[model samples]
Target: MFGWVSGFFTYETTKSVVVKSWSVGIINRVAQLLIIIYFVGWVFIHEKAYQVRDTGIESAVMTKVKGFGFLNDNLMDVADYVMPTQGASVFCIITAMVITANQTQSKCHEMDQKFKCKNDSDCESLTFSNLASGKITGKCIAEAQRCEILGWCPAENDIPIEHSMTEVEGFTIFIKNSIRFPLFNVTRGNIGENLKTLSCTYDPVNNPDCPIFRVSDILMYAGEDFSNISKKGGEIGINIAWVCNLDEHVDNCKPTYKFTRMDSAFKNSVVTKGYNFRFAKYFKSEDGNDYRTLHKAYAIRFDILVSGNAGKFHLIPTVINVVAACTSVGLATVLCDIILLNFLKGAKQYKAKKFEEVSDSVSRSQSLDLHECSQKTIKREEKSSDDSGAYSIGHQV
Candidate 1:
């Protein structure tokens, strides 16, 4: 217990010496240089280890599409082509649609030729699910030789429809984007001056500051043709990237836009080829009966995706990286020490000089006690001898 108590306050000391060896010296210096380059050049200069990072972003987007088209021998304006007649971050303009007008709730005519049967026994009663348009009525239509279902009358036609609105190639889309870096307290937008934004279109070389984009140009950039995709419809992605270096001027923090085709082209395959959805317009007649016009809308969907990160100088990371570099440098010293004490010709001598055994406090105290006891015993014997001689002389007298 006493030894442990004393050891708690005691510190082990080491002696420092300089050893000159070409092989060890060269290896050590080379390791140090590599570490220095990695830390100073790569980490500090290239990666900017001194800076902290912020990935949080706040963004808003508004888009407007303008174009003209003709359908069913009638001219359509921008409002007719654009859905909902309002601007949004994500919007679609109708390139093609299959209309099923005057649809009412009644027995529907089954169009599948395979579903044709001689009688009710061949038509199995089935429930209506999302995949199927209606439930089976277990009846066969004599004229059509197809099974009759109790649902919307005159079921939608399965024939493919192709309507090309190639005029949409001239459509112009104005995208307004505002992004903020909360941590850095910086805000940026794609728009420059109001006049420039209104007049100029986005051109990588000439007018990069403009936010207005042409639909044809975007399709071209994504390796697609507007006329080819206008009939079947497809999806296009708009990516806005904001890479900010807070150390530079804030004007350099503007967003860059990129285009990509998200949906597969029609030439690839017949299955899952294009983008389309069903929508209905309902109205009440004079007799107070409800009726709806079901329309299968095919259009190009533009999805706007935004991403970015901001970085600024900070002290905590800088210190941490510096300390890590220094710690790595110590590994070089360790390598040299291993070679000097275990591999070289004079390794045995070096090892002997480097390491020494130490005695514990208990063992040292016991050794001192034994030496004192031996000395005491020798003195007592000498005193006893002197007394015996004096007594013998007295007896002789």
Candidate 2:
């Protein structure tokens, strides 16, 4: 109980220092140097360890495409080829189209290759599947041996049409982008000047600042051909990246753009062939009858994707990184101590000098008391022996 009470209040501490060796010193110095390099080179210079980061970005984009071509021997303008006419941030221009003109609400004609039947039971009063163009009426056109669907009178032609817009090679798209870092209170725009962007084109080596890009150039950058992709539509992606260091001047912050083709090339397979969609334009005849023209438009889709991150100096991160670097330095001392006490020559001697057993005041007092008790017991035994011998001699006399 006494020993436990003393131990509860007392603690052991070592006070010896080992004579340092060249090998140990070298190892420690190397460890310290590595820590210093990591803190200064990587954390401070490269990663900006003193700064906090904010990636929240606010962005807006405006895009416009310009081109001209000949469609079916008719001169076409940008207004004729571009969808929605007014243009949007994301838009497409038709490179190929299948036009079905002058149609009214009537029975849809069936293709000879798709629908085949022998009698009315095979073609009449049949519910069409979801993939069917329209609902079938209870009438079979025996000549075609197919069901009639109550839809646009004349069915759209499925004949293959190969139209190419090679003239669109020189077509250019103007992209205007503005980005803001709310945390750092910094904002940047791709266009430095209105006239500069209007006249220049995006060229990595020569005119990188220009926001105007040629469609053909973009296709080429993505390892695609304009002539080949024009026949069958595809998707193109435009990526704008902004990495800003708030410590520098705001003007230095600029965006870099990348182009990639999102869709695979044509593989001559019907399932994964190309991208196309159908739209209709309705017109009223002089007799007040409704007529429409259906157009299957195939065009390259452009998707503009924006992303960014911004960073600025802060005291909290700096302090945290500094503390981590200092802690790593202490690890070097611990490692060297392990090597000296366990691996080096004369390690046992060094261990004995380095570590010493310690005792509390209570333990010392208890040890002294035990020694005194043992000495008193030995003296009592010797005196009893002498008394026994004297008593025996007296009795004999």
Candidate 3:
């Protein structure tokens, strides 16, 4: 009875030890998972976003920390391992929902068009003749379909922005030619990545008297991957500047121009590429000093660049070899096909000639036999008639 009691106690002790070990193992796993989740969500995703923002256009970036989606595929390693618990899954879902809602609001605001220009003639309203002195004030009565005022510039007649008009003529021509080009069909949401045209107005904020020139149909490509871009992709910067040339236009003054870059700064506005320099104020061209015109107009362009090192060596070498080999094979095939076609045509002509010769020989033989038979019939008829006439005379005697 004592032995039995001891055995019962030992079994209970073993069971408790087993339960404690299992509980410890589970806790360790959960802690490890949580740590991994926090690290990846806080570090890698934010780092990538910051890098994207350093570039000069507005950008909406969405990174998934939860279930599988486009960008979440990249995060699957950590997310799947950590999200097994009900609490973790719920947390990730909440985070994704908040991000998505913010994206919708941002997108809705961006899609709201804010600028209007009735027609191309409205572009002429951007002349310096319409600017107000001291307090910049001007207006062009030109009508436009729609226009959004992004920013304005102010310039002093005495202190002109430097080098703003150096490439005025060329820049003007580019603007005119750009009109001939088609408007960029920017996608409205996260479905596709593209740059949308934003209206830029250059009127002095302090003084409302300035001629506002409108840049229409500016071309810009987004620098974000499709999965990373938000439904409301982001805003494009419309940089503008008011630059005056003091030297060439002013009597007895050294040639110089005052220039300033202007644009609206918004959240998610920075992308991987630098901001557009179209509206940037800089001295351009040292020669040919007509600095007073202030006829320069500018636009922005955005380009996205993607860099990765996976399969670098194998991919490049394989592609190079494939292209070289394909070109060679294609050229050889084309040449061989041409040669074969020509040979086949020659052979057919040779066969046709042989057939024509045989036909000609048979026709000639048939014609010769027909002529000989006709001649023999004619001679036989003549001889029979003569013999009959001679027999009749002998009978009469």
- Give the alpha carbon lDDT tens digit for every residue of 1-397 in model 1: 9979877876565644355567777999998999999999999998888899889999998888876887645577877767656677777877877777887788876776657678777776433323344677777777788777776666777567656666778889999899999998998998864443286778878777788999989999888887778877888999999988999988878788889988754447756777777888898899988788887777888888889998899999989999999999988988888887778877765665566546577769988887878777868888877443221111111
Looking at model 3, report the run of 10 residues with the lowest lDDT sum. Answer: 172-181
Better of 1 and 3 by lDDT: 1
Sequence-dependent TM-score of model 2: 0.76
How far off is model 1, as Cα RMSD?
A: 13.9
- lDDT tens string, model 3, 307-334? 1111112344445544554454444433
Give the TM-score of each candidate: 0.76, 0.76, 0.15
For candidate 2, lDDT tens digit of each residue in 1-397? 9979876896676454545467777888898898889889998899998989878999998888876788767677887787766556678877888888998987875653455556667666465644445676656777777767777867777667676666778889988899888887888899875344277889988887898999888988877787777887888888899988888877778888888887765536677776788899999999999999988887888888899998888999999999998888888888877877788775666666666666667789988887878777978888877443221111111
TM-score of model number 3: 0.15
Candidate 2, superposed: residue stretches over 4 Å from native: 1-32, 116-126, 138-140, 193-197, 264-270, 331-397
The pairs that clash in candidate 1 are none
Q: How does each model score on lDDT? A: 0.78, 0.78, 0.26
lDDT of 3 at 37: 52
Tell me how far the alpha carbon of residue 374 in candidate 1 is from the true structure, in angstroms, after superposition: 29
